[model samples]
Target chain A: MTVPAAAAAGYSLLVLAAVVAPAVVLESAGDRGGVRGAVGADLIGVSAAVGVPAAVLAWRGVRRTTRAGRSRTDVWIAASCGLVTVAVAASALPTVVLHATTGLPVLDADAGWPVPALWAVCLGAAVVAGEASRRGVLRWLAG
Target chain B: MPALNRRQFLAASLGAVGSVAAGTGLGSQLWPLMGREDLVPGRTPELVLPAGAWSPAADRLTFAAVGDTGSGGRQAMAVADRMARGYQDSPYGLVTHLGDLCYYGSVEDRFDDVFTRPMRPLIDAGVAFELAIGNHDGALHHSDASLAEIDAELRLLGTPARHYTTSHGPVDFFYLDSSTPGLFGDDASVQLEWLDDALASSTNQWKVVCMHHPVYSSGAHGSTPGADELLEPLLADRRVDLVLSGHDHHYERTHPVDGVTYVVSGGGCKTTPVRPGRFTAAASSTLQYLHVDVVGDRLTGRSVRADGRVVDRFELRAREGR
Candidate 1:
């Protein structure tokens, strides 16, 4: 119960961070140009669209795991949710950092590749971390 | 392996055909959406300038100018329609874009929707467009990627350099990339030096400068202090006749600041409310475009709205010996 509640809260916080923080940073940077407004709205929309369902499914999986014990399917579902949340967070980090540092609202020309690569790495990491926790490997390793 | 049964073989073949058909249908629909050319019609009304407005002199040159029109929405289409109509009547060979070619992203990503489709009528009619990098168009204040993408897209649109000079019959137009660093600082010295050279070498009767930032504007963005500091001295010293810009989403023409008429023809697609400042001779928040006719020493300018209403008009006569 505690694990599920904590995970859900953390996931929600991650989504909020990714969607809301960038807009604040950008507004503080300078004028709210049309592009920044559109991009900010888009980030919020995409986060809500992808985050809500992922969080719900992840919460359900965590609850089932708590009652029925760890299962491969349940772990995978939770891992997928984490992957999505992390990927979105990672992708937005560059834009936010750039705006904060230079008051620029755009990513670098080579920025497109880093986002997809981050997503892939996040997906892999989520899967590995989920499997390790389910197997108690993370607990043993931590010890 | 055993030979496939007749039933299984038929089902597999049908599945393959069905999959291919579905993929084809989806691709066809997605392609046009991505290109944003789906909404643009094949033909639109040709734009016509008013009677006797077209300059008959061989030395005279005509062009259309607008900015902040990257929306590719209804208002943008309406303005583009009017521009096409004006082109039909006067046959202007060039169009000047004052930046913000595409809102919310690099022009490379939205060029099809924001530029190609909306301006199709004019493009097909053989009109060439010159671009200035605006803040929304990925200027110096935007990310490096945005700047790179915009530069690449500009090249694709036939602008070889971000800042360069081009000439018409009697006008030497200096296109400055004001989005670069030193816009108000020492870095502007490079552009200032180039501008000084360009003005000095030009043998044309009329000298004009175009950039994305406004040096004298009363619109929402008001005047860019840096641009005023860096460019005004050069403009006044060289006796430049006209300074064209767009950033504030409105139209404004200033009383000559040191003999240079500052015009903000930014009402290309979107409209933002504006109040007249001390230097403003005329100002409006209508979606509009500008048609300028350079005949002899006089430059006649008309601001035409999306619905074809001429909202503002003014003239600038070159000073003696300019």
Candidate 2:
């Protein structure tokens, strides 16, 4: 339980440093879309690189805790943390696709459907990841 | 199964409130300092225009020139305000943009913020603008798609072609796309050949050439060696009256090099410190635009600052015969 919690915190911090920090720097430089677009695509790559290992470790820890008969609250907390990590990783996908397909760095403020759709995908990933981990499916895969 | 004590609840609420206050206070203090320099209010010295400089025989051709003005900030608006006021007194048909039209021209959305909004007054007044593509005006360093997007937007904003000419009254204006690889780098022969032909064929009395890169400047970015080497001889041979450029973000007038005057009117919206070089007759880091009136053989220019002060003035007379 402690291991998964630590991994979740570490993953969040890594995402903040790797992805969010550079985006903020580029935005501060200018409101132009070139640098921001390049950075946004790069962020998706970084998230994928960091996410795979984090998901594996989190699944392993969940299996160890569940087999040890930990409390439902403890298992739930661990699962929630894993889901949050997955959510952060999932949110970057639409941005990457948007940049790859149409070279727009930052979407216009009036971009109605795509923006909401991206949020929806992120929410869906969180819910799915949390449910799978809680049902011990992630644990079964790890084993 | 333990409820929060009254003390704990109050303490947590107080801490949250305190954190918010501290964050707000710090942000307020640092906000103004971000991405801005501390400007001191001081008047720039005015340049004196010689009496009876304009020739009576030639028809008057008036225009305003500025560069690096796509920031659409307060300073840009102020400079545009001065331009608008100057236009009313002495009506000018054209506004020559020395590029950096919008920061990171790759972004289509920024066109409205940087170029359109700030210069709305001039545009609404039916003053047409001609652009000399700058480093920031296109995605020259970025991907192909970005480059295409920027070029499309620039065309929509009235850049007829990358390198072209427009004749207005007495002045034959030749605009160069200096930001392109072929022009700025080693393979500049293509543009140079075209420039030579353009200058030689021009029938106008006052031949003026405009580009984004300055041939000679005393500002931060000094001078571009490639441009000076390739363009100077053509300008000298043709006896071009004025060569206008903007890249260094300041105003500078140079002593004539081989019968050609090189002027840097880059102080559109932003400014940086400048010092006079060997060729620099006058230099200022003030935010300014050049209000030039060509009347026959004599070309009189006044460098006007944002606050409506003329910081520099000069006159160039067309050489006798050709």
List candidate 1 segments past 4 Å from native: A1-143, B1-58, B180-182
Alpha-carbon deviation at A113 in model 1, angstroms: 35
lDDT of 1 by residue, B65-110 (tens): 9988876544566678778888766778788889888764556756
lDDT of 2 by residue, B1-322 (tens): 4453453344334444644653453244322222122111111112222222223233668898988876654355557767777876677778888878765234476566566656665676677889888877765653577477657656767678778898988888999878657486555778888988998899888888899889999888888866677778888988888999998878999999998899999877666668999999998877789999888788899998766778899988986558
What is the per-candidate TM-score for chain B? 0.81, 0.81
Alpha-carbon DockQ of candidate 2: 0.03
Model 1: lDDT of residue A93:
43
Q: Lowest-lDDT window of 10 residues in candidate 1 chain B?
A: B34-43
* Angstrom error at residue B211, model 2: 0.4
Q: What share of the true interface contacts does each candidate keep?
A: 0.00, 0.02
